[model samples]
Target: MSEDLPIRKIIHVDMDAFYASVEQMDNPDLKGKPIAVGGGGKRGVVNAASYEARKFGVKSAMAGNLAAKLCPGLIFVRPNFERYTEISKKIRAIFYEYTDLVEPLSLDEAYLDVTNNKKGNPSASLIAKDIRERIFNEIGLTASAGISINKFIAKVASDYNKPNGQKTVNPEEVTNFLEQLDIRKFYGVGKVTAEKMYQKGIFTGLDLKQKSLEYLDENFGKSGRYYYHIVRGVQNSEVKPNRIRKSLAAERTFSENLSSEIFMLEKLERIADEVSKRLAKSKVAGKTVTLKIKYSDFSLQTRSKTLPYYMSDKSIILETAKDLLYQETLNNSVRLLGISMSNLNTEANKKIEEKSVSVQLKFEF
Candidate 1:
């Protein structure tokens, strides 16, 4: 870590089981029950699971049937995007009260740069506390926050104390905090990557730091450099208020594998409709349409076509997907189908706003 590098107060705010929490808040009967906000049918995937359900190993993206088997008493509620979006707006509005450098990661979480803020508060931890308190009082839901010198550490810290709690890693504590951290807890390391790290005997941040840059690069490629820097607290990514979305997509897994094109058209129609609706909601169009197929054997394939002009209409999207579907003969039965749009109109090269940093500045814990 270099003392000359910039020090900015970054806070990551994540809503607690956002979709399930909203359902619980709206319906008093669901307050303490194990609830999942999504379809509970055989083919359905759990979008979000309440904390109560999580104790039984129910989690988002788990198959509804598996979740049901894990928590037999779980209740399922359909998703209401309009309601979630409405509440998300209110939460973001609260964030803007303190900082314009707010970067939303999703409807349920965001990164806020409050090194200098409208409230003129010098303590980022205090600001995070205030923000969480306001969300609870105003939105009728709980939120968790992480405060630190950068977005990565802040994101990791936020998970330390969850479901209506906050964690702060001070500037002086950053190195020790990260060194003692579990390899799996590092933000970007998923299950597969963690397993790979385990095979390489890198099970902790200290273990990761012990590997040479050459050794890591030889073993992990480009991500090797990323691990080297982030483990040593050298991430320089900023919070961009206008982060552009690169792509939009919608996908569904089926209860039964479809072997013929006739059976797929109906599914394609529904998938295209979803993609179109999402594109319209974002108010963006794309030039490329992609068809994703997941075979019954779990082999994945994608076919894409870049159009001369951008489009966001359901009819056009469905037609393009249909064309891609018919472009090739079925290699195997497909258990999942997806439609995606890329080269979006939202993509653009915009200058990132720069801020000045003072050398050896003091940051409150």
Candidate 2:
């Protein structure tokens, strides 16, 4: 431990099967049962599942039919957003009591910096425990907490002990903890990156640390540096309290699938209008236009293009979205079509770089 280095007390809290647990809490019959919180339909997907359902290979984002096959007796329930929002509010209220430096990643998970909490509590572990207790006593839900010196380590540690357990990686033990960690478990290493690392003989944090900075930079680009530093427990990213919304999107499932490009284009026009309205409501503009397509088989894909400048014009947004759509070879009948804007420029509306551009795109089959 260096005397000049600064250390922080960061904690990551994640709810245990949040949606499914909420369903079970509302109905005693659903408790200790294999339940999934989502509809069972040809195109529907599971949002969350209880531990009992998870034992049978049921997981979130899985197709409804596959989830049913994985667990024949699985119970499916519709989601109640109002109820979930109410409970999430209660949970966030508890976090604020301990520290105002709370960063919620989603409704079910968040990061808290309890380094100088309002509770005047010196122990980060005790603060996490107290918050968990409050959630259980007040809301009747179990949560897992990970406490460490930084956000990266804290997020990883939170998953070390699941379903109401907590793990703390103190400042002095960070190096050893990361060294023993598996490469697949690293936050930024996705399935594709993991395969690449396996081919390069980098299976663990220690192996990753063995790579030279030049090698990492040459091989993995910007993310290569992230892995290099993370392996040595050098992550310094702060737990941001108010993260700006990165994108504003709108989507809808069609009553029937459309195979005709002309029909699909009409539907997309409506979807683009919806997305533009949302961006306007949020007062945000983005450089990228992404088109989301969901097929009859429930598979999803997206295509995006980043422009030279930001704009929220409906015509331009729709034009770009249409281009992205026609570029993709539609292999299946489309069940849903959506358009979104990302690479968000959250700065207030200004004329600094506002300009008009035109393009003529004609769809032909």
Lowest lDDT sum, 10 consecutive residues, model 2, at: 356-365
Clashes of each: 0, 0
TM-score of each: 0.92, 0.86
Model 1 lDDT per residue over 30-86, tens place:
999999988788778899999999999999999898999999899999999999999
173-205 per-residue lDDT for model 2 (tens digits): 777888889999899899999999999999999
- CA RMSD, predictions in order: 2.7, 10.1
TM-score of 1: 0.92
Model 2: pairs clashing at backbone N, Cα or C within 3 Å: none
lDDT of 2 at 184: 91
